[model samples]
Target chain A: MVTPLEIIRKKRAEAVNRIVSKGYLSTIRVYVGMATCEIAAGSKEVMEVFRQAIANGLTDVYLSQKGCAGRCNLEPTVEVIEEGKIPVKYGRVTPEKAREIVERHLKKGEVITEWAI
Target chain B: MEDVQYKMMLCDGVSCIHNQSKELQSAIESELDKSGIRDAVSIHLSGCLGMCNKGPILIVNPGYTIYGGVGSEDVPEIVQSHLVEGKPVARLVIEEDHLYNRFFRIFGDVDFFGKQMRITLRNCGVIDPENIDDYLSVRGYEALAKVLCDMTPEQVVAEVKKSGLRGRGGAGFPTGLKWGFTAAQKADEKYVICNADEGDPGAFMDRSAIEGDPHTVIEGIIIGGYAVGATKGIVYIRAEYPLAIKRLEKAIEDAREHGFLGKDILGTDFSFDVEIRLGAGAFVCGEETALIHSIEGARGMPRPRPPYPSVSGLFGKPTLINNVETWANIPVIILDGGEWLSSIGTETSKGTKVFALAGKVHNTGLVEVPMGTTLREIVYDIGGGIPNGKKFKAVQTGGPSGGCLPEEYLDTQIDYESLAKAGSIMGSGGMIVIDEESCMVSLARFFIEFTQDESCGKCTPCREGTKRMLEILTRIVEGKGKAGDIEKLERLGSMIKKSSLCGLGQSAPNPVLSTIKNFREEYEEHIEQKKCRAGQCVALLSYVVNDECVGCGACKRICPTGAIEGTRKEKHLILDEKCIRCGQCYDVCKFEAINKV
Candidate 1:
């Protein structure tokens, strides 16, 4: 019979496995602000553009949607989390700009200095 | 093998979800899949990280780096460089200095969380609330296990007493004393209840707590039950909080399955179970007696407080009822010890208090601070001061039943006694920072109207008295106030305070009374001069075309009434006879030509 301590250990291990299996240990992550304010600021369209770019065979990218980033005035904000490097936050991104970000920043390892928040 | 080396937590709280966090989450998952490193990374949809205005917020583990204002297009680059190349992204990091300076100015450059002492909110933004394993890993049920295995019911109550926890539901009643009162009663069947019917406008502290960490509240409730010698626990949550309800129900089921709740919990003889009761969103039900009635399937109304829910409550038996935040503090008190918890806050009030900072503040969000923290620190340091550089006016605390304190009271310490002495109650921790632009008369009218509507009419003083007060306040704001209106309001206010049946009636006059006490000059100006200095009362305002008028016909063209007249390229004039005082001309004019005085 499994003791309570054993159950707790099992649960912890399972949780860790679940997180590890889902690629949380991956080196980089991209977060898109999709809060209501961001959506009103056309983050949905920007997200679609990114999806289309990835569908067009963009490789090695981990894209996820996040909630409001606090600054309502700077909606449609994008955050890039790359391992061993400082994360970059880009603001006021449009769909066309989204495509440009994928090609110039994601593909070429270049930071878009102008759009950073 | 440590298969995962990094963790990404995305804020999925109400505000974040409103900002399209779901779309952001899906985008991240697809990017991870595309990167072919899905097995190495984990994405957690967590609760509010408090920096609401800076969403959608993303926190990366290993270094605890937070990135704000993220977008979908930035996903691929983040994965390729950070995950594959083992290099952290420099530009995406939420600037440590900026975040620290923005929210923690009171504590000075400590980061957004530096000023906050998060006791009840310990697990909220840090963990995925829906997952039971996540809760267990955080030592969630350890308190319940300890209470059942080691501490006697009296001993548990004594520890809580030593902690000096007061109800976060607004009354500031000593929680330990309430538990003792209920435990001392001899009864066959007793119940411990969690009051989650958070009905205060602009107050989301309880909702956020439940959403961020449902298991913590459940754990607290189980401990309360053990202390009070109750076998059954009930959480009386409002139906409007569907997300919190969903998570809490899931947590209860998981706890039962894990032997933390139900029949012989943790293999001990002490057994306890919990159930959920939905309140139909009545503000009055937040009161303990009304909540008890609602749980019993009655008309959610409050009777006199002789029995006080401790002696006779919910099916007419001994019961213990605490607010959502009060329950959330339980596990922490057990883990940290009563003395440790007591040492943090003021002498009278112990532990931290969670406040939902709203209104015209720069950094409007949820903040938890120690009890002795002054209102000045909260407004300026943590809330980032009033927005648009407006002069800080009065701040409203304790919902409609609480009073509004003027600028002079800004340094007042935020505890029950201190706030009461300052003419405002600490309430349920809804701190609305009023700006110079807000009219005190109108503000008083708003609270009176709210209390009048929510009054159950059980008592004559609250039901009819509030309506009469609202009429006088309405007349005063409408530029038709008489000399004796203020006196009449004061008289009625004091009468209601003395004669009211429940807490709702007793505190109904607080807003009107406090506003008059603090900003009496504004009231006098509204009555005697027929002018609202803030220009909020439209009835007392007049529109005029100023010297700066460039008359591009913008104001003339948009004016619903043809009050603005003048040819193109010339200064416009407002015809006083025809002007409706709608302020449309003021809004439409590109130049600073139109003025409302």
Candidate 2:
């Protein structure tokens, strides 16, 4: 029988491997601050915008919700991190701005300096 | 795996769920279907972020843009503008102020999390709490595995002892010593209990901890059971916390399936199983002995402790009981060496404390600060000071059993010894900030009322003594106080403190005693002058027509009693005999005519 230690080790290894193999380093990553406060601030709608963009054939962009980014007033926050690049955060996001981000920033490979927090 | 182009994550925390995050998820799914690219994106749910005030947050990758307060109605617009156009939404972006932007420049963006050190709350908002895989990725059960494989039970006990970890549940008893006593006992069966009966008003630390990371608490309890040679573990939580209980139940089920619980756990001779016991919401049940009694299906009254629970507990056998916060610390201490934790806190109290910061404060939420961090930092720097720029009067710590500290104590460091020296015990991290608008006498009366109602009536000193004290406090606040009422309260409060049974009765008078010690002048003013300086006591306030009275008939029309006698557009005279002191005239006076004297 596999020891409980071995079982735990195997599980932990698999979990970590899954996270790594998901292309965090290679893929473009997007993080949403979806703490309860952010969600109340309409981050869910902002995340939906990203989902729609991806469904429209936006590729290699990995999107995930993180806990609060700590700036509560800037809820419904969105962040983008590319390989070997500094992450940029946007605060007080509306659905319209989310769509604009998909067009101007995500597709054109340009940072929206005016919108970035 | 399919070459997924974009990933979107939604919050599955209880708060988001309440905000219809599920509906929002489905709405996005259908929106993707409408675009005929459903397989291009994937959606997943994660745990609560500390920003509970914001909910239903969503994240999209590639640009790492976060959207807050997203509603279902706005879904189609997001899809059309962002997805079809290949442009991330600019309109929906959250914009913070310049100070936060500077912090982003100076410290890489600390924001609301700048002053916080998240040791206990590490995994809370980071992972999908319900998914065991999410927990596993964060090395969730690593500590237990280490304890089972490498360290002996005695070594585990010794490690905890070296950490200088006092119990987070009020009285700062050394946790390791309690475990050692139970371990040394030659009983055939020993039990470990996690106390979740958090009865302090406005406290949600334990509830949030359980909801965000139930597995941690379970892992801690299991490790505790292993270290103390106990085969059974019980989590005694109040039934009021339904969500926490549900999450904890799910976590236990998952752990058992993973072989973290049950016979020969982790392929060792050590076998343990955990069960949940629901408390009936008694404040006294937070006491260890009373908690043990409640677990045993008894009336939940605390007994005298020459035979502490460590020596003689459940079923007449030795038992180890630690509060929810205390147990939450065990796994961390085991994983990170005791020295690592000891280095972070004060010499006497090691590790950070989680406080539910509420009342009259700007940022009212849960905050965890390292031991020896000043109250000033917590109240001003973290809590953003008193709301509306009101002068902070006093802060109440440690629930009703704890004392209230005055403004002078703001610089005082938060720890077991420092707080006690300031005439307050750190009772389970309930920090309520009081403002100048609040009356101190009324505040003391409010706490006494709560404690007196929840006294459990088990002992005389607590039952009768608290009743008498409450009566005196009530009279004083109601403008009927006599000259000797303050002395009567002090005498009764000290007597109850010295003679009560259990912690509930023993410290029941702390609010009265501490308020008297710090704000005696307020009490004297209430009694001697028959006046409430803060104007909080209605009975003591009498509205008088001042020189500015325009006799607009507003006071006359609004007063329930015909207390104001004057013609229109002239100064009104408020009759003292007929005036009920309702303060209707005071509120209705547009001319600043009626003054509450």
Candidate 3:
């Protein structure tokens, strides 16, 4: 039986050999806004829904968080990005709605027109 | 290199957190499973995205669509329609006229973001803080790289000096002059400090910066260290801000790994590192001298300044200290020439200011307005013009250390010099909007109460004088104020402001002074008429069941001492002696009964 640590080390070595770029990582990014304005308007839960969705599936998405956009009053903001698109910005998504985003928007390319601005 | 694919992001700041965001995570997971395309989509939770008045935010990447005021129930609909169909969520979209979109509608067109330049907050909400690559993509450490690879220490200091950029952490000291003072000294291990211990009662500009763009501060510090030829830097943040601390720690690790920090950063001779020191939540630590003392493993108390921090700072060496916001600005100033940076704002005050615009405003949140924006624009256009259509009475700037600008001063340009001219100091950019329902006397007393408690017993003027001022304020709020107390407050305030040991004590009297300057009539009414005009001060209030009472038992049930004696559906009578005047009963009453006059 192989030890998990050794296996992880071996896999890491393999990953390094396979690495195309130095000190590089394949990143899938998720951004949650938790500024004071967002809190008052309740964006915390909206971010959490996505977190749970990702944690359950165990996808390799890198999480980056931030503060208010100076818009204040409208909160529970999240932005997702890949290598392009200059950041896909979104605002005011709720928890249950977060599930819809994951299922329909994330899993499928179809975005809920009612929710998308 | 492969182009970026797809993403789904959500808001998870205070506004979203309160709305049970925890449950939404599971829902998203389960929903994605049903679609069998979860592999293609990635979901992430992030901090506040602002414009929280309409919240529970979400943004879908690749198409750049925003949905506002969302709920858990709307999840399936979004997935089935927009997510599956690739359509816009129009119903949830905030369709404001041509502006910065739904995200910054309240602030973008308003003076809060329009009048302000965005040097310090350039990448705040636009970029992701956790990803070094995102920061890199946005030219994050390019400034640091430039400083290390090209400019000499003298050149760096000279450029900064040419910009005429002053410290945003009060006292308005030029950044270049301070850097020069530190650079002139020959210390083997000089230090660069970012004073992130923002202890102002309602001020959270520093907190927002750290939480929003942690790398900017890191880049700023690295640049500052490179400019001053310092090998080390320290960020003194308060323990109360866990999010900021967490992000900053991550930023440090990332910078070190990315060759922006640690030994031979970017394979250059320049080597700099940063550490986080959490202050024990003392308001006085906002003062530079006290902050240095705190960083030196001592109690945060200000010592009289003769040998300033620039000469003999942390650990008995020349140190350069600037606030988080000030540090946040360095990268932009360095990247964009000093001339471009100097062009914005007034001659004295350059760059945009980030303000925690709170209280009585419709779109209350963190705002980055230009230096020369008027109070009217920030309050009206950006703030959504006060909740429930209330008239704007005043907007208080500078936190406890600032003065309240009255309605007459609405059009006054908000720069350090202009604010000071209007009897307020730009103290850390805590702009609190006050409406008609707010009592000036109580407001003044509230700030005095905060200052009195947070005062370190280092200086007699701040310690004893604040206590005296608090007492006098308490009296006025209780409607027990004497005629002569106003004169005494003025005299004492002048003395405290003029004679205090440091910035804390000197500016501690600002709330009292500014409120008095603007609303002296409120104090006079409290003294002469023995009334609390806003009906806030309980001591001056007397509960009486008025004719408008429809026999609602809310007041009776809510009264702490059973002060109200009434049957169901009958007018109540307050037993005044039994009433502790908690005012809970007054707020609970739905009818026009329970008069507090």
TM-score of chain B of 3: 0.81
Q: Write one digit per residue (lDDT tens) for candidate 2, span B230-303.
A: 99999999998776787789899999988899988878888999999999999889999988888888898889
As for candidate 3, its interface RMSD to one decimal place is: 12.5
**What is candidate 1's lDDT per residue for B1-597, written digit by digit as tens?**
123555577776556778788888898889889988888886766434555567887766645666777788777777787777766677777753221112211111122344566678766544557777657656667677667656889999999999999999899999999999999999999999999998888888887778767898999999999899999999999898776788789889988888888987777777899999999998899889988988888898999988778999989999999999999888877766787677656789988898888888876767888787789877887777887879999889998889998888999988999999999999998889899999989998998999999999888999999999999999999999999999999999999999998898899899999999999999999999999999999889988888887769988888888887899888888888888888888787788877888
Error of 2 at B178 (Å): 0.7
Local lDDT at B553 for model 2: 88
In model 3 chain A, the worst 10-residue window by lDDT is A18-27
Per-candidate RMSD vs. true structure? Answer: 11.3, 13.4, 12.2
Model 1 chain B: which ten-residue window has the lowest total lDDT? B100-109
Fnat for candidate 1 (0 to 1): 0.06
Q: Is candidate 1 or candidate 2 better by DockQ?
A: 2
Q: Give the chain A TM-score for each candidate.
A: 0.82, 0.86, 0.64
Native interface contacts retained, candidate 2: 0.26
TM-score of each: 0.78, 0.76, 0.77
- Considering every candidate listed, which one attains the maximal DockQ? 3
lDDT of 3 at B329: 76
Write one digit per residue (lDDT tens) for candidate 3, span B354-407. 788899987777777656667887787667688887778888988888889899
